[model samples]
Target: MKNEINIIIITPELSKEGGGGIAIYTQILAKELSLDFEVERVVTLKERAVVNRVRVLFLSIVKVFYLLNRKKRKIAHIHTAHDSSFFRKSIFVRLCKIFKTPVILHLHSPSFALSFKKKSEKQQENIRKVFKLADKVIVLSKREKEWYLDNIEKRPPLVVYNGMNDLISSSDKVSERRNTVLFLGQLGHRKGTYDLIKAFKKVLENYSDAKLTLAGDGEVDECQKLVKSLQMDNSVEFLGWIGLEKKRELLNSSKIFVLPSHQEAFPLTILEAMSTRLPIISTFVGGIPEAIENNISGLLINAGDIEALSRNILKLLNNTLLCDKIGEFARERYLTHFKLTQTTENIKKIYTELL
Candidate 1:
């Protein structure tokens, strides 16, 4: 065996709690990759790739020269960049070319452009330029790849569905009497936090005991205000930013997992809920459909459709057998496709080929 592939994982952030799914992916993937590769993670402290508030270009240039000066470095991978300054991109691209190293551009965002809003001309041009520089573009889902394929004239992307580490140890511990519907993920417009509240309000007509406990954080005050406005303050529990222990705790007690996201690239949260045998009710967006087979593993409703979201939630709540059946199916699907080991093997293949 070739002893180790010296690989560097460069990203803007690496905080476990603050960085969301990307950080989780980096942490887990790096640990797994360490088996075959000597992985070095270099994260910028701020949004700008800075070293003590200095530009990343300066330090990246220093790092690249150091690597090139030393021998046996196999790959220099850059993870997730958005709307970077021209100097950073030029310096990075030029350095990679000079060193003759493969640069893997891993894209975490569902959209190709930096801002989800209407893109400025400069932003559009810069995005295209960045795409051109990458040797390989690793997209998290097929839906995300579609945007780049249609818009950018660059090397096409590879779709690698986000993997889930088998952290749900208490799979047998089922909630016998579940009264709560759990929403675990970013609480924002794109995530459909508003729609979930509206649907939960509608659900209260018949299943008055049904309570919504939100896990994770984003626009927390706004989401809480909406719940209060709907007089769901009594019905909803805003458990903001639960840790791993608390996340598992919430998942165990909850009847159903709901994510009414308008845009998603693949959610690890859904897989986690599934592993714990909670039936899912999600919007038919992104890789969610790739995983959820619309009432098979879970129910998939149209994004922002409050009525359909409520209907699906109510269906699972009313039929205990249906909930159990769907939960079983969801767990089986996760085992088959989304397991950490399986995903790691697939990623290893990609790295091997690239190297």
Candidate 2:
């Protein structure tokens, strides 16, 4: 029997074509919650072009207003990022308030605190007002929750770590994987793509047969130029904007996963790597330290420290026993703390409380 409760999830596009972690999280939440609750997903920001986006956003607001006009009690779960995304979702939050419907603002921006500080004081006040209107606010990490409490709002936001289903299967074995280091995200300075390329040049000095695969879109030509300048054309391969199957294949085939991002809020890529039991090498920023205990589950270094990044890559490459141990621990951590079911249950509890 289906539950009587209704959940309307408003987010950006859910398709893999142009979606990121926010879209993936929204998809997972909708899928898992649909089994019990009456879940509906509304796509707001799908177009890349600005004029098109404005048109779509207006239509979405109209549609949501219609949906909320009904007499039934409903909840609005709005997923948003920084800058334009925040403003876009704020409209829906206001609509919820007009209808007296409960609204849950789920923030997904990795550098929200930094970006919020950079905004003008008036804009910052507007953001704070939006948060105050929401019935509840959900952050991706404890660090983010504290930032929101101190800066955005006086009320404490709930910290629900982004979670996903395990990608590795019983047949997959780490010993059978290749000597490949994989990076999955936008190929730009923010994700430290150039730094990873520079560090990989150092890794090639020790392991000539090792490979580096970069999978994602953004600044591809620039990254390729850097790779070529370092004389690493043969060692580095760029796969632009891959889908789920290709991501799974790369995770399964690769020996290590590296995402030396300058900023992050519990990246889904790290969780993806952890679930596959590939020892991770990432920078200590945002909520990374919470998930990855240094030298235990995975390795962590300060952002932009190319020497340390290279050293950690070599450390995992040289010691097979240590790599397996860290990978095993990472999998255990994922199962215990970051499972999709756990996130769904926590979210359900919040919904129950609000209803």
Candidate 3:
């Protein structure tokens, strides 16, 4: 037990500054994997200043090579998304292969299929070279697995839902929640922040006491201008890039959580909302429907439909019984299916089998 085999998790960065979703997932997954294996995490990218970026990459390369040289049973569990992440990790994947270490390429990129379709033939050849070197490939959702099955010339990618520590708490249930809808993701058209803002502006018409708290940062100035232009400056508050403690506070106070993304493989924020027992109202895109059941765990609306988004928000805000019921079901589902315990167990099996 003390001398368990090592597993190296390669990612852009282990910290939050690298970006959300994958950064958060890699950190949480690495922490969980550490308990079962001698996990050593390496970052191929960093949130460094422009001048120091190349220096940082060089140091990381040196460190990774040193770690890979260690004489121990090891598996390179590379958590790769599409685009430059795959490019950056090519050397790591090659090194692990040269070392004869089992490689697990975990795909988190949402638009992998779309991206691959657009790639030039030569570019496609290079990408396929990386895929051929992997002992096994893992993806975040069934849709992603199917995407790889159609593209990659290998056995189907295994589906492994990204997991996190239980967000349930003793004082979890808020005795008196506010009439606020929370949107936690990057502020952009891709995440449907504009649609959320439009729907939220309408939400204020019926429930004037309602507040729409938009957390996370990206094009804040534009979103703020949109809110101001719509005369929703007073109702909408953009709390840019909050910490875990602050996130919990916001989740606790809010009645409903939404993520109207145009694209996503699986959203960690929804899982967090589910864990916090918030009635979710998100767009049915990518793997969201798999995590949320329409009128069951939470309500699901079509993407870009502000009318439906607004209707769903008002539906939950007005109906306390339904909100409580859906929130309860969401939390139960997280405990049963999306918890770290279940995900880590599956990861352990993949590691054990891949060897």
Candidate 4:
């Protein structure tokens, strides 16, 4: 069966090192599918330099053309975000259509609706045309699927929440975790990093010993400036762009995980925190509400609400029993819905249907 079906996963960069959620998603999907199918990964954008990236993209197009020309039962699984990522993957979708091969457009963008609304009418139509070309469209959340159904195209997209392997062990104990709050992802305005910093400052008014750790790359200088301005330099630590092992260590040691993003389709970091049995405090945006029940598995606050963010953080920190309960419930939800095996199986069913 592995030799009979060929699955081609298209992404900007396939490496786990310094890759965003989309890259990580592609890597996991490709690895799992390879166990049962002949998997090929086509990296369309790898180089950091603009000229090199453009050259690589062109080469990827040629490579896709050549691969589809071969005699095989193949499916092109293209992972894309908004704006340039969408346009780049649309080329592959068109090429797959030309070869009469099934293509799946897997969207991982949180602000895709906003991006689409910013485009001109003709450009919006072009975007719709590209979406229509694909044999199937997969979204990260049901909310996203509905948005596409009402705005992008009438065909409803399949929802596939991002999943992760469980990261907690029996030896891991809540008593051993520190009073540390962890935020993992790009450090920019969209992610509400500055808001989190301000909220953390407020949190320090009560629990002065509480620490905030910001990991991942983006606007580090700006975020540092904000931290300094808020007099949180001593309390807030920024570790730019960490690897998987470091992320796991942070998840295990941190008492809480918070991501107050202005927008998100579905964040894999939330699932990672859940898998590690860490109480989460995130915004009520995108598919987050689907994953977290308010005051149950985790706490949810509106985006950019610094006061609410601070209050929620304190609510969990002030009560250890409540924090442990939320963390345990989060882990339960992860095991029931967002485990890596379950996600891979759902994706495999889509592939089978398309085939």
Considering every candidate listed, which one attains the maximal TM-score? 2
Model 1 alpha-carbon miss at residue 1, Å:
8.0
Q: Following a full C-alpha superposition, what root-mean-square deviation does model 2 have from the true structure?
A: 1.3
TM-score (C-alpha) between model 2 and the true structure: 0.97
Candidate 4 vs. truth: CA RMSD? 1.5
TM-score of each: 0.88, 0.97, 0.95, 0.97
The full ranking of all candidates by lDDT, starting with the best, is 2, 4, 3, 1
lDDT of each: 0.76, 0.90, 0.84, 0.89
Candidate 2: worst-modelled 10 consecutive residues by lDDT: 168-177
Off by over 4 Å in 1: 14-16, 45-69, 84-94, 113-117, 120-125, 173-177
Q: Model 4, 105-124: lDDT tens per residue?
A: 99998889999999999999
- Residue pairs with colliding backbones in model 2 are none
Per-residue alpha-carbon lDDT of candidate 3 for residues 1-355, written as tens digits (9 for 90 to 100): 5436888888776335546677788888888878768888887777646556567767777887888899888889887877767887787889888888899988887777788889999998899889889988888888777767777775877888877676655444533588888999889998999999998888898999999999988879999999999999889999988888788888878889999989888999999889888899987888888899889998988889999999999988888888888989999889888998799999999988977
What is candidate 1's lDDT per residue for 250-273, written digit by digit as tens?
887888899999977788888888
lDDT per residue for candidate 2 within 1-355, as digits (tens), equals: 8787778899998334848888888988899999998887888988788887988898899889888987767899999999989989999999999999999999998878888989999999999999999999999888888888889878899999888888885545566679999999988998999999999999999999999999998899999999999999999999999988899889988999999999888899999899999999998899999989888999999999999999999988898888889999999999999999999999999998898
Which residue runs of candidate 2 sit more than 4 Å off their true CA positions? 14-18
Q: Which stretches of candidate 4 lie over 4 Å from their true place?
A: 1-3, 14-16
lDDT of 4 at 150: 91
Residue 269, candidate 2: alpha-carbon lDDT: 92
Better of 3 and 4 by lDDT: 4
Candidate 3 displacement at residue 221 in angstroms: 0.7
Model 3, runs deviating above 4 Å: 14-18, 48-51, 170-175
